[model samples]
Target: MSAAEFSYKLRVYIEDTDAGGIVYYVNYLKFMERARTEFMRELGYGKDAIFNHGLMFVVRDMAVRYLRPAQLDDLLEATVRLIDLGGASMTLAQEVRRGAEVLATATVTVACVERAGVRPQRLPRDMTDSLRAARDTNGN
Candidate 1:
């Protein structure tokens, strides 16, 4: 497991909040997803590159805990880390925070799947190697 973490920050908009102006619980997962995507992009294997290799990543499992509420216009930071890397799957630990306050945390397992049938598949060697490089570059 690598200790490297990537952080993405964004402001909650009115559309991201409930009628009461609190962020919807499920939206935290969306924010985590965006952070994961950007982490992959920063690794140089963006969506297009993954698809070109005949594979895509899909969430196979997730466990999330919500600790607090975030209101509209709150600046939220989502941090993502690769906790486990495998031939066919990657497990990520993510946290959503507002300044020093931790609002949500999750552990997500993502599996490599065939782009056509969406069936489980081994991750490309290049991707695995690149992820290792990315981890090292981030000072893991």
Candidate 2:
């Protein structure tokens, strides 16, 4: 798939922060996860479709870089772009930004697997087609 970008907006709340009032390091991953979910949802892969098909996507590998801290009540935008697609896996580039300032970035690889056995499986044809068709003119 081409680099099709998608974004999801979120607000940092107390529950997402540490005692120091900054977002916890792992919470950035959570933000990126939400962005990916939204991206798939827009591609017609909602909770039901994902969980009911006997297959689901699971993160296989991830690398994250935290650049800045986000404070409580900060409005953040999490972005996802498909950078690579394979028969059974896909890699995404993700970022969490506060307005124009990027706070974190990640490269995530996810694989499709059977829900019961968790064994890797090829991506569904329709899902791959939808991902290839996805586009965002305003993702910038």
Error of model 2, residue 43, in angstroms: 0.8
At residue 16, candidate 1 shows an lDDT of 95
Off by over 4 Å in 1: 137-140
* Model 2 spans with C-alpha error above 4 angstroms: 135-140
Model 2 C-alpha lDDT per residue in residues 15-115, reported as the tens digit of each score = 99999999999999999999999999988899899887888899999999999999999999999988888999988999999999999999999999999
TM-scores for all candidates: the values are 0.94, 0.93
For 2-41, candidate 1 gives per-residue lDDT tens digits of: 4678899999999899999999998999999999999999
Candidate 2 overall lDDT versus native: 0.90
Candidate 1, position 82, lDDT: 84
Q: Number of clashes in model 1?
A: 0
